[model samples]
Target: MTEIFVKSLPLKDVISNLAEAFDTVYFNRCQEYQINIPEKYGTGFIRGINFDNGFGLLEYSCSFKESLSIHFSVNNIHPLKFIYCSEGTVKHRFEETNKLQTIDQFQNVIVASTSKNGHILLFPRNQKIQLNSLEISRKDFKKKIDCDLNHVNVNLRKLFRDLNARSLFFYHGNYSIGMSNCIDSLKVNGLDGFTRRLFLEGKSNEILSIQIEDFEDDQKEEPKRRILRKADMIQIQKAASLLKQELHAPLTIKDLAKKVGTNPTKLQEGFRFTFGLTVNNYLNKIRLDYARDQLMLGELNISEISGNIGISNKSYFSRLFKAAYNINPKDFSKKIKRNSSQQH
Candidate 1:
């Protein structure tokens, strides 16, 4: 396996430093950046969006073939960040305590506080990692809001206040179901230039807004959150992937749990804790999304689409599709055809 050597860069202005790390990094007319690292080690792109204000975003959808290890330190108050792992995993360990936190797929947080000390990020080989690092300078972030900080969500306000001190604070939770869908909608595979920048920045702010709402909801949770063993967490995630693979099959939750090597109770609670949706709700979401795409493609009628996705009741399928997308399946397909003809 070939290992890529990385030079140390500044952490305070993380986005700009990211711009410098790549051999093919450039800023577009919009001041957004496109970063392409050496291909021998990994393949894919990193997109960065910088606003006139200090708000910024760095989105990574790259996979490495060899392990990556880096040591870095930030002396200044680090940018307040909202980190989400939409795919793969990322681990962070501070040097002083060596305590670590791992963010798994579909998990998110408005970063835990960090000491001014150094930390290391490890990226294992063969894992396709997709991450969104949204951040703002502590000073700029504080200025962006006009209202009294104290009146904001206690958890959010507390996170900001932690920036002023030498201590670190950490909160790990899942984003709202709406936010998770938004995350899935971020398409970066073949995008370029202004369109890519527009989507990244717009969606970044939208996710940030929902993150604030998440923080408020975080305060309402009971003091105790169910803790799962690392092995159990892995099994739960395996179950989720299985669900996606067998999305059209009419497998009950019991079968799902058994296949993933966990009990029904753990499966339900784990789904709720990790993905912010129950098993049935999550399954329906993916199925409906698939049906909607099939409808847009004009490949199948409502009945075929519904049956293909394992919904035996045609009325119920239409109701579910309409409730989720606000458009009847038939009309959605009609609109797709009409637009295609108009373009022609």
Candidate 2:
């Protein structure tokens, strides 16, 4: 909510002392949120109870010439942190009490707590370093993706590192300005509150998608080969049609599969193969498309649209509709109305 900027402050003695002083004051106000950065060692720490309001604030201390250790701790309850490193290589120690590990220069690190403690250490290359922390919650996270987390972690790190490396190389080779300019853009163009929350949610899903793509690329598992037979496809189609007709009703995959004279697994496989999307995906697409059509008629608001579509959660319904249509439901409806007026 509040942005504080400090420029060219003394890093070694003064800045560290200031950080220590601030930590003492911050901890006293709210026992739930605690921060400690010792004056002797070039390190910092932050802890928060809930990520609802967002992560606790911190004062970054770094010398333009010295390499500083920026220590961060997120309790197990807090969601993953998407960190964008602006300058220098950051070695990250994933969970609490783990060996010191490093995420090389120009990379984004996703830190999640497996148990109750998660931590990260940033080793700055230059005194002038910039970074943005986007806090994400597990509840708002969606992983419709079908890959194991352990399998995806390594691949994700590699993919991000590769992307950052390529981007940096291109910028340095072709652009007039250097890496500093790029870092400035990244830090300054940081998202506003709503967008930052959305970005965090999107990034989590993006990570999962990357893992799914990795699996698809490796050819270790093939969906086409495991697709259902013609008979099973027919059953799935029938079930899908029935579900489509009853779009205003609450339908479960299990019940739908049973109604089609098949089990859930076979139905899911067949539906996915036949439609090129998961059963839930197909169902949502149908619902949203129907909602769009109704909105074009200019007869209902979002709440009514959600209710008529058998989705009780209006916010979730809006999110789903936006995800499907590439525009928010309200905006899509407004555009439709504007187009109608133009036609008239």
Candidate 3:
């Protein structure tokens, strides 16, 4: 494995140090710096930008020809980092320790080294990898915020106030959908100059907010369940769209799970997380909602509406509709017709 040592503070200088190690030049525009990996070592580039608020963003989209480790060995207190892996896998550990933690695709880690211990990031050889690191200098961030820390969560408050880097902190988990969307937006919209800087700054803050919220949610005392990855969320969304489009052919949980590339248990958990309902309950709600709209159109009778939504038993469908909307399907349809007649 090859190793590159980066001994710099702030983001711009970090890019410069990396460029020196890679034996390549770097580009700078509007305080953002970018450097491409030399052909001998790898392909792709690493971009970084530092905001006036002490927040910085470092994006890595590259692959190395051999296993590589970038060691951050700054002499002063290092910035707290929220590192996210969007593709492939990366390993991380404090420079002072041998234990390493692997961050896979769709996963993230919050890391702060004690004092100047620094951090080391390892990338496997010949694998496409994409990662984003949100770096925050606590001292600068505190001054920028210019607010009391009493309102913050206990763990986070301590983290924010530890400007001297008195203790170490680390957390790992699957990134939430909000964070996934924020990360995706960073790669879109061809904005440049001040507009691009402002856009990135805004997104940086948004991603921080989401990270804090997700950390808090993870701390809650909930039942043990599988953590949902971004891929799982996408599958869950596909299942929902399928359910809506095929209202006349409702699928069983196992079938729906198979179609969506997830198991029944994960499907149920994802539905509950995304929609606050189980899979069957969500499907039922969708069917009833669709039936309500059809009834309002006055083009289908109760029996036809029930059949259209894959409910063979009209009486059972009526019970479900009444439970959901507090009115029997027949009565709701009659009310719609009566209101139409009155209008005419």
Candidate 4:
């Protein structure tokens, strides 16, 4: 098993004086990648920014060793990128692109790029990139902008190209500041996944509605809008119900969506809007709540409780339980038992 180290810092508090912080968190539990933190200066400086709902924005910069290669796997569906650069430079080569391009210092702008090839090369001499990884689903994004996915992609690409074509635009010759400000607003005003789904869906529909009004003014055909009807709401409710019922099963978004007769994307949006939780978060809450109930019953050991909750790996279960409850499962059970005995 390989382990990857993760370090996160809050930037809103530390960005004034250009201060830097560094540390390494152990990752022996992850079986995927063995991440090595070289004894390099100023490699893991991160500042955290809170977004709307439970989402978080992280800004960080790293300087890699000459010819040093780091390898890791990524969940392909989620969108990821390094959108802004304060200083220094780095070249990224993806399996999809043969050429390596240097992303230089661009103040107050967001750069949107994808990493399908899973390889990024950081130049040695103090390379810095202010990255904002928006953990938004493709479906939700479409709803927010009230455009089809393909059209949205085309428009976004055009936006990026327009920004790049100009040496200087608005304040910083880059559109990153505008995008970042917009994201900040979304993070501050948007609801949690559950609430955001409804908000985004409504917003998207509203955009299409406005577009329709414009078309009417121009005497053109109205554009078709992808609105979530009553059936869609019912399907989302059904999926949430099923997920709640099968708390101990390996519930996947795909499986839940299929069972409810909807696609994964819509299922995700609907679940978030209807339940105020992502599918995985909702399921985990179910499992954790069940585990708590079992602990209170005093009939099951920690291992048994974990197993019954469908967390087959005892150690992983313990860690997860601790992360959620702020105590190890065994200790939590003991505390419950002690309290029960005292009450009697």
Candidate 5:
């Protein structure tokens, strides 16, 4: 790891300073100034673009080779930063406050200028480090939008009205798996050049939108239907675990509920609320994922594997398998067999 000192005396300096300091930065068009840094602080990549609208997009997946501490004296004026960590944890403390706030795995932080001038962000080594951050220049962002940004989050509305204030406003919450998946897809895409610029811009906007939705969802006064008490939900979740471990057992909804010391209604509702799937559908997904592994192993026919996962009707199982993965189980099995034969 590098022992480093970085001071974005004003928030706007962070990006420009980084581009000039690191040689690993690469981008589509030299005109776009869109750069990707592969070995900043350690082994990982930071890819982003400096859009024409005076905003920037950034995604980070860096594992510090050793402990790295950042002392940032950031006096950000009108720039707003939205950061989400899908894998590791980041710790920070503002210059004015002793209270340390941590953005942990699957959590996010959205900060805009409020009444503070400086803050500190610390990244721990060997942590699962994955982050998506957006730095939007207030004046430029306003020029790009004609309507109020109220649809995203109420805090955004507050920030818009009080642009002159010099404070720090932030929101912290759990990020949806859907949001994590979206960022992961961006990390793995093969697109490049001008087309990559288009993709990056679209994804940057989407990530911002998703983070705003996270805050709005947090403020929901009305809870979703089928919500279960936390304690009882834990028991029901344990039952789900049991069902997964005993997939070959022909456990009905009623049986599973009884085994887990809850009613069928609670069982079904807890599964839906916790995992966003009905009990049966959740079971099917688990089974199908397992079946795919078996298909790749080339050890059993579709019928045998289907029976192993508690699906008996072979034809119906094939339908479910195809529906789940968009490939017939038989075809998937054959593909694996062919690949294996070639390997031998």
Candidate 6:
């Protein structure tokens, strides 16, 4: 196992310290600091950006050649962290605790060590892990957003107000789909320079809000109305698989819900929550994506392609295809043919 110990404050120094450990240098652009894993170590990258508001983001998307553990032992108050495991498993524990927590896919943990206590993160070798850490310096964050914590949940409000790190805090929950989407947006956005920084800051604030809300919902006495729980996520995945398997003969929302052992409303809610699309729209997307592939093959007419995907109306299919791809099916097919002939 490879172990890297860090005792740095603020984020830039942390990234620099990590880079030094990896035998590589970190680059900074528009306040974003990033480092690629040295070839001798593994593959992929670790990047982070800190905002002026004391909230910062650190992302790890890498596969190490060997097991690794990073120990953060800053001798002062550490930042509160909202860590999400988007892809592989990650094990975490407080520096002073024996109990270890494993964060699996789609799971998140909110952690804050007691004053001067530290945190340890373990990454298994050969696993392509994608993790994000949202860090907040409680003292700085409180100064920026210091207001009546009346609207915040009692526990979280207290956590936010613990600027001195008077108590340790840890909570684990499945992150909301909204938070997932927001994080994705942060990674894939095209903005650059000052604009990118502003966009990231805005999204960071949005994500923090979502985290607080998810924690509050998880704390609810009766969570029957929670549509994004682990059980619901499983049902949603089942529903999606069903949709894809029966794309040519899509089921009604009620029938699909029945197959998934959920009500139509909850099923729809699940779809919206997990996929950001209603059932019908998601089905349409499936159909359209399939149609685009068939069109690219240049073997089937637009009507046949549409029919094969369960769209009966030729004109309606054309409209949906146009709306989705910004070009009519016929034109898309012709363009494909033209390109094929030109290559020949």
Clashes of each: 2, 3, 0, 13, 7, 0
Instruction: Point out the higher-scoring one by lDDT: 1 or 3.
Output: 3
Q: Pick the candidate with the highest TM-score.
A: 3
Question: What are the Cα lDDT values of the candidates?
Answer: 0.69, 0.50, 0.88, 0.47, 0.68, 0.87
Candidates in order, TM-scores: namely: 0.58, 0.34, 0.74, 0.36, 0.62, 0.73
Clashing pairs in 2: 63-127, 64-127, 91-102
**67-145: candidate 3 lDDT, tens digit per residue:** 9999989889999999999999999999778889999999999999998899999999999999999989888888865
Kindly indicate the candidate among 1 and 5 with the higher lDDT. Answer: 1
lDDT pick, better of 3 and 6? 3
| Candidate achieving higher TM-score, 2 or 3 | 3
lDDT of 3 at 275: 98
**The 10-residue segment with the lowest total lDDT in model 5:** 222-231
- Encode model 5's per-residue lDDT on 228-317: one tens digit a residue: 443455677687798779877658888888778767776887788778998999999899988998888777777788888987898998
The superposed Cα distance between candidate 6 and the true structure at residue 56, in angstroms, equals: 1.1
Model 1 collision count: 2
Rank all candidate structures by their TM-score, best first, as comma-separated numbers. Answer: 3, 6, 5, 1, 4, 2
What ranges in model 4 sit over 4 Å off?
1-230
lDDT of each residue in 59-134, candidate 2, tens digit only? 2324323444443332324444555454444565644455665543344444554444445454553444444344
Sort by lDDT, best first: what order?
3, 6, 1, 5, 2, 4
Name the regions of candidate 6 deviating beyond 4 angstroms. 227-231, 239-266, 271-344
Evaluate residue 255 in candidate 1 and report its C-alpha lDDT on the 0 to 100 scale. Answer: 87
Clashing pairs in 1: 112-170, 113-169
Q: Which ten residues in a row have the lowest lDDT in candidate 6?
A: 222-231
Predicted candidate 1 versus true structure: per-residue lDDT over 222-325, tens digit per residue: 32223332335777888888877876685799888778766776688888878889999989998998898888888788888888888889889989999999
Candidate 4 per-residue lDDT, tens place, 10-114, comes to 223223212222243322211111122336543554333433322334434455443332222243322223233445554444434565655555322222334
Residue 181 in candidate 5, Cα distance off native in Å = 2.0
Cα deviation at 59, candidate 1, in Å, is: 0.5
